[model samples]
Target: MSDTPTEKPSNRPSPVIVLVAPQMGENIGMVARAMANFGLSELRLVAPRDGWPNDKATAAASRATHVVEAAAVFDDLRAAIADLNFVFATTARERDGFKPVRGPVEAARTLRAQAAGGYRAGILFGREKFGLDNDEISLADEIVTFPVDPAYASLNVAQAVLLMAYEWRKAGLERETDIPFTGPQTVAAPKEELHGLFGHLEAALDTRGYFRPLAKKAKMVDKVRAVLTRPGFTMGEIKVLRGIVSSLDYFSPKEPRGAGYPLRKAEVDKQAHPARRAEDAGEGSDD
Candidate 1:
C-alpha cells in the first residue's frame, strides 16, 4: 500500500468501479485495492481475460480482501453497466466520436454530484492494452481521463483506476455537498409504458406503410427500440410520442387490405417516407 493517508469518506455514495475486458488478474486486484482504499465497496468485472478469482489477484489485494471477496463478475460490459444510471468510461486516448471528456477532478465532481441527485454512477476501465472499444464507450454517458506528463500519459489499468478513485474520494470529502443521487430511481419512462408506446408506434408506422419491404421491418423496428431503450425515454416524452402516433393514425387512410389484414408494404412506405408523400402531394409552396 502507498503510505498516503486516505481521509474517511463521507456517507456519500461511492461511484461503482467497472472493469471491462481487463487483461490481467494483478490489475484487477490492484483496482480492487484502489477502490477499497477510497471506501468504495462495489467492484464489477466484465469478461476478464484471465479467469476471475485467481490466486494471483488475491495475493495482490493483500489488505483489501473485502473488495476481492465481494467483487462481482459479469459476462458482458452492458450487463455490468445495466444498474448504473450515470456511467463514465476512462481512457488515455481520445475516442473518434464525440463524448464529453473530463479530467479526474471534473469527472469526480460530476459523478459525485450526479450521485447526490439520486443516481448510481459508474466509471468503466477497459483493458490495459487497447482501452475501451467504441461500442463499449457508447454505453457511457461521459469519458474521464487523468492528466499525466502529456509525453508519457499512458497509464496502466490499475494506475488509471487508482488516480480516478483518489480524485473522486478527495473531491467528495473536500466539497461537503448535501446532494447525492440516492438509490436507483432515474425518471426514465417505465418499461411497461415504453413497451406500450412502442406498440403504438409500430401500429402507427404500419398504417403509414413505413415498414415496407417485408423482410426489413423486424430488423428496422429492433434497431429503433434498441436506440430508444439505451437513452431511456421519459414518461412525458412517451406520452407525447403516443399522441403523435395517434394523430398520425387518425389522419392516415386505411389500406384496402381487409380491416383485420396485417399491414402491407405500401401502407408502411407511406408512413415511413412522409417526405416522399409530401413531395407527391405537391403541398403549395417551396420552403
Candidate 2:
C-alpha cells in the first residue's frame, strides 16, 4: 500500500443557502461570513431587500468575499431549490404545522447525515423582518428553529446560520449510531425496508380494527401508505415499528390465559351480549 495519508471523507453538503427577501446588506454579508466559518461556500439570493453584490455586504463578509462574489441570484425560492434533493428552512415563529420543526443542533446533525448519502441539501433563511412565509416554509422538507428564552426569542439571521453550520460540522466527527437515518456516513433506508415497514404498519392497524367500514378499507390503506412513504421512513424506524407489532401480538390474548384474562372476559361478555341473554335461553344453551 502506498504510504500516502488516505484522504479523509468530506461530509459537507452542497449547502446552498437560500435567503428569501433578506433585509439589510450587512446581514447578508454576515451570513456569508458565518458560512465561511463553517466551510460552506455557496449562497443563493432570492430577492433580497438591499440588492445583491452590495458593497456593504462585501465589507461585512470581510475575507470571505469569495462566497459573496460566487453568490447566485434567483427570482424566487422554488428556483433556488429546484435541483436540490433536500431543503431545510430556518424560522423563529411557529406556523401551524406548516413543516416539521427541529432544533438547530438536530437539524444540522440531520443535514450532515443526509449529505453523507450524497444528497444536495440546502439551508434556507428567510427575510429578516417577517421570516419565511407559509408558502416558503411549505417548500422545505423540514424547518429548523433555535431554542431561546420564550420571553425573548430573537435571533439574527447570521446567528441562526452559524449555529446550524457549527452543529453540522460537529456531527461529521461523531461516532456511528444504530439509527440508519442519523449517522454521518449512512444512507437513507432502502426501498425494501420501507415496504416492509408499510406492511407491518398495515398489519398492526388491521389487528386494531383501524381499517373498519369495509367500504373505506382500500382508500384508507392507500392514504396511510402515502403518508408513511412521503417522509421516506428509515431502516431504524422500520425495525422499531416491527418490534411494536411483535409486542402487541404477544399481549393480544385470544383465549383468555394471562393476567388480563378476567378483564378480557368481562369485555367480551358485555360486547357479545348487552342483555342478560334471557335466563331460560342461557340455561338451555349451556346444557
- State, as a TM-score between 0 and 1, how close model 2 is to the true structure: 0.57
Model 2 lDDT tens row, 257-285:
23332346656676688464554347545
Total backbone collisions, model 2? 0
Give the alpha carbon lDDT tens digit for every residue of 1-287 in model 1.
Answer: 22343344456578889988878888778888888877788889998788877777888887987888888999998899897899999888878759888989899889878877888999998888888889999989998887788798788888888888877777765333323333445599779999998888887766566776769999989987887788787898888888887886777455542244445887778779988777778864486
After TM-score superposition, the amount by which residue 224's alpha carbon in candidate 2 deviates from its true location, in angstroms, is 72
Query: In model 1, where do residues sit more than 4 Å from their true spots?
Result: 1-10, 175-287
TM-score of each candidate structure, all chains considered together:
0.57, 0.57
Please give the range of 10 consecutive residues that has the lowest summed lDDT in model 1: 174-183
